[model samples]
Target: MAEENKQIAEQLIEAVGGLENIESVAHCATRLRIMVTDKEKIDQGKVEELDKVKGAFYNAGQFQVIFGTGTVNKIHTEIIGLGAPESSSSEQKKDAAQKGNKIQRLLRTFGDIFVPIIPVLVATGLFMGLRGLLTQEEILAIFGMTPADISENFLLYTQVLTDTAFAFLPALIAWSAFRVFGGSPVIGIVLGLMLVNPALPNAYAVGSGDADPLYILGFIPVIGYQGSVLPAFIAGFLGAKLEKWLRERIPEALDLILTPFLTLLIMITAALFVLGPIFSIVETGIMAAMNVVLELPFGLSGLIIGGLHQVIVITGVHHIFNLFEIQLLADDGFNPFNALITAGIAAQGGAALAVAVKTKSKKLKALAFPSSISAFLGITEPAIFGVNLRYIKPFVMGLAGGAAGGFFAALFNLQGNGMAVTVIPGMLLYIYDFLPFVLYILTNVIALSVAFVLTWMFGFNDKMLDEVNQ
Candidate 1:
């Protein structure tokens, strides 16, 4: 075990370029993510060759090394120095002058929810989306021939897929929290599962509204921590402290059973009552802050949204932004106050499309173009992560183009006020359908065209296209 661990530790250190080479260490889902000075300095092939590595994939400015299982605790120890981010100004500056580790934190939470079950979600999402289409037209009923019980096969299967992801979210988070605290996440996962069970009210879909999900913990007013990313975050923070203490004091034989029990009691108690509410309120504040920013200025708003929209995608937290989009539309169908979105789609999508064409790396090109098309079709994730953000030049150019386009869109009062990106099909979805439609379509075309031209002009120097293609 020591030999294997030594090898794993060595591989990790090497992958990140000696222990000193690592600026920061973090993990999410299948990847042991790192922040480094230069990605070129690392040997990609060696990282891939490691027995535990699933693969390494780079996109949207982040490089990731995949580890299938037994990853959380191992990588967790490497970061946070087994417990605590340094309080010194230098350490904070190091963390700050860099990417703020927000990506790392967000990725960890997302991993808790969907990473473990991505294949299932996609397969099931496809099935459910198709089945919904089929059933709405009574296609499925034709085969079964029953009004009351037409065909739940699609619904059943889709629910199975969704339920697994949702129900397991807490447990997954627990594991992550454990790892974050410098302990075995498996036990944390066990306690998280306890909260996620169906028997627990306010466990699933309980975070949004006016109710506290936590009913009680044997009569204490513990809040619900189920289906929540932040709760686990708080729990993990405390759990780590508890784990370090137990590790020193407990005897080896009884430690395994006894330590976990104490961690559970203490962590759960703190998470359910004290920390849960605080995290919940903080999450609400973040959403409020982003919405406030959108109202600031067309140019600034566009720049912020355009630049970070892809970051939102890479972390899979774009859904949080999306909730705001929905609310904005609902509040004012014909509202001009909202930051113009159609232009954002066009600018980002255009930038992605441009990179798709310019890159000689056929694999990246293929992913980029089709993904851009998908973004055009209202799925910005693939385009933002796979294409635009990969090349800094294109991403920045697109943001500039997006800001210009969005400003023009706002000036024109071009409002696609109904559905978001996919509403491309129905221009009437815009309140002032004619002006906004013309402006949106025109700007999207122009910005994207310019984005493509810019990427070809600038990125080719760094792309190493000639060497790679040769």
Candidate 2:
């Protein structure tokens, strides 16, 4: 495997115009993110055909070659051995700055901020699911106890999982955003601490009217930025720029002492008095817009999201939904969006399986079967890049299946205890609710059946398989 990775890395470096022409290289989740000195010198088609490469595309000022999860990391290490410099902090900031138009840059920044924080959220979400399961009436009966019989310490420990991440979310977001925006992360973290100061009223208390926000200047209200994303992101950007400004003006002798102090003072005051309240409102408006879509009559929201969710995945922007799901779970205790996305994922697997069952090519069948299994495990890239997208018709069939399944999911108001994991891995999220669990399986089955039937009917032929071999 190490030898294979080395060869793939060498091929990748050559395909991207050699180590000399590359400005920087990095990996994120599933792709080799590269910044080249000249795009025309790179052979994109050759990169796509390389062993272990799933797909390749250019977006946000980077050429991204997908290698899935573990493979990308090994190849990345090999690339470093082959003399491609790993991107420095400054290089990352420059790449981020070069990303796209204003809107795309903002979206990309949002993704950068949250991608680092998702694992904790997923772990906590799973704990929440487990907590719910242990406390369920049925489960409690089996244990010969009632919900009240659970120990206080155990319940408190559950809060350690379900509550901690959202509570300190600002710190995480600010730290990442500041790094991405070319600022000192320590200063950003200090600013985040100020935003979520122990002295400030908890955001939930303010929202629930159990406590009042401090009135600043007799009008503006200040509250802890808990479960808030946009505020932290906005504040991080401002703070990073402010720190850079300070670094430029302060003398070297005083830089260490003064830069962080002044940056924190100015940015914290501005966040409390101006940016925090304003961006909080903006965040509310965005969440409201999302709710409007989900609340649309007759499951239209589900049908639309289910039908189109995988398209977002293909573009690699589905991480944005992590923000939405985390916010939803923090505020509402459940996530319907993830439920719909699960349907889409299952549909992809189903369509791939159908193609696997029908194809005459041993290689295509081999790829399709395992990709389908991977999809069922909540990782769909294998099925997507290996099979469905290649055939085109299977992908469309998957979309149709996803729409049908998602329509039913929303119609039943199915919700999960988590955001990230889905399909079999997602079963934990619904195990506490009998009907929702049944509904979850039903949604997958419906997606699989529909996609399987459609793909079997019209998606594959011997001619297509023969062409694929060529």
Candidate 3:
């Protein structure tokens, strides 16, 4: 197995114009991301045809070859062992930054800032779903109990699990943004904590009219930023910049004391008096706009977003949705976008499954089956780049499936208790109620059936695979 992996690695390096043409190489969960010295020298067709390779694409300045999860790791290790310059994901990202347009770079930055924070959010979402399941009236009745029968302490404990992350979400965002922006992460945490300080009026309380904002200079309204994304992000950016600037100018002897002191003093003042209030309004407006779109008549919004979601994933810019989904969960405690996008994700699996069942070639069948399984399990790169996308019709059929499913999701007013997980594993988010669970299942079924049937009928045949292989 090791020798075979080494041979595959060697073939991959040669396919991409030899080791000398390679600038650096790295791997993510599923792809071997390579930055080459010259794009013209690489043979994409040969790379795609190589043994153990699933598919290949160039995006954000990297030539990414899908090799499944464990397989990609082995190939990457073999590549490094064969004298290729091994690069960290961070270094590869830097190379990517030098290639894409301004908007692409910005979206990638948002991705970097949020990717580390998603696991906590996902766990919290699961906790919330579990709490909802336990507290549902019908579920309780089945167990011969009522909400009142549940222990108050247990309820409080559930709240701790579900609420703490969101209650101090600004801190996490700030800390992450600070790290991304090259600032002191500990300082960012301190700054973020100050934004949600118990001393100030709560932003949610102020919005709900339960508490008035504390006035600064008898005019500027001061409120703690709780459950806010934009405010913390902006504050982190400005704070990091200030800290970096002060570090450069401060004397070495007093750098530690003076840099943080001056940085915090300036940032806290700017954040409370300026950034918080301004960006809070901006954030509210953005959320309001998204809600208006989501509430569009007859599920038009879902149809449009769902059809285009995977197309965006192909561009590698889909991570921007994390910000929107996070904001939705923070403000509304429910994420409808999660329900809408799951259809798109499910359709990818469905389309891949169709191709897997229809293909005759042993090699194509081998790639398609496992790739479809990966898609059903909530990772779609293999199914997408490997199978469905290679056959253009299947990808389009998947889009149609997504549109149909999304329409149902919006029509039924489906909302998830959490975000992150999707497809089969995403069933956890809908277990809160029988009706929601049923609707979630129905939506995914519609998506999967539509994609699978359409692709089986029109998307694949043995001839196409034979031609590609030839």
Candidate 4:
């Protein structure tokens, strides 16, 4: 496998205009992200044709070659070993496209910083959903008991698994943000730990009015940052920049000792006294606005967001929505945005499956089948980029399907206990209630049937299938 990856890496190097044209390289869960100096120097078509390369797209100024999951990491490692200077970070690559827009850059930075941390949250979400199932009155009644009758230790174990991540989310986000911003992650982590120090009142209690906020300057309210995203992000960025600024002026002789010590003292103070209070207000307002949007009339919000969600995904701005979903989950114990997003994803899968069934060309069928399955499994890029978008009609049908699913999700007030992961794998997120789980299945089926029927009627033709093969 190593040799095969290196060989593919060699082909990819020459195909992307070699080491000279390449500026930097990185990888995500499924694609090899490359930033090149001159777009015209590389042969995109040839890169697409390379063995094991599923598809290629130029989005937001980055040339992304989809190599699937496990395969991408190996190929990316080989490419880096071949002397292509690695990109400073994935956000840099994401930012190369929208550098002119401040909001875009900030959103990309958040996306890059949080992507690594999402897995833990996803696992916790799944754990929570499963815990709800096992402890449900209905599920337990079948076994002659209720949640109250469950063993104390087993319940405690489940609580630890499901609640620990959210309780210390600030630390995870801070550590990741600092790494992205070029600071010592360990220092960042320590700073994060300080935000949730035992001496301070818990953030949830403060929010719930169970505990009073600490006062600074006799007016500003300082609260511990637990289960908060925006404040941690801001604190991490400032902390990283401060560390860098101090390192430059401090003499090398006593740098190591002084730098870390001073950085922590300064950042910890600012995060507690200044940044925490101000940014916490800002985060609170943002979360309030999201809730209001979700409450919009006749489910118009979900209809529109669901219809355009995949469009945002194509532009790579969809990561910003992850923050919104996380906030919703943290604040309300449910995420309606996740349900809407799942509709969009299932629609993409539906469109791809339609093409796979209808296409006459063996190659197109081969491409569409697995890509559709992948989309159903919560990875939609393959279906979206490699199949549906290649046929514009199917993609349009998908939007219609998505809008339908979203409308119903909103009408039913459908929600999940999690963010990230959708469809097949997403069942873990909705296992909390039998009704919600049934609705989840129906949501996907509605999307699937609508997109499939629409595409079969209008999306493809034998001529397009021939072109696809050629």
Best-matching candidate per TM-score? 3
Decide which is better by TM-score, 1 or 2.
2
In candidate 3, the residue pairs with backbone N, CA or C atoms under 3 Å apart (3 or more residues apart, or in different chains) clash, namely none
TM-score, every prediction: 0.50, 0.90, 0.97, 0.90
Let me know the TM-score candidate 2 reaches against the reference structure: 0.90
Better of 1 and 3 by lDDT: 3
Per-model C-alpha lDDT, please?
A: 0.54, 0.84, 0.90, 0.85
Clashes of 3: 0
lDDT of 4 by residue, 1-470 (tens): 78888999999999989999888898887888888888888888788767777688876668889877787889989999999988755555555845336766777777878888889889988998999899889999999997778999998899999888888888888899889899999988988888888789988898788999888789978778888888888889999999999999999998999999999999988888889888888998988887887888897877886788998888777887778877777775788888888888999899999899987877778778988888899888888878888778889999888888888888888999988989999988999989999999988888778888888899877677556546
Candidate 3, superposed: residue stretches over 4 Å from native: 141-143, 467-470
Clash count, candidate 1: 5
- Pick by lDDT: which candidate is best? 3
Model 2: per-residue Cα lDDT over 132-186, one tens digit each: 7888989999979998898999998888878887788888888887988889998
Better of 2 and 3 by lDDT: 3
Cα misplacement distance, residue 168 of candidate 3 (Å): 0.6
- Could you tell me how far off, in angstroms, the CA of residue 347 lies in candidate 3 after the best superposition? 0.5
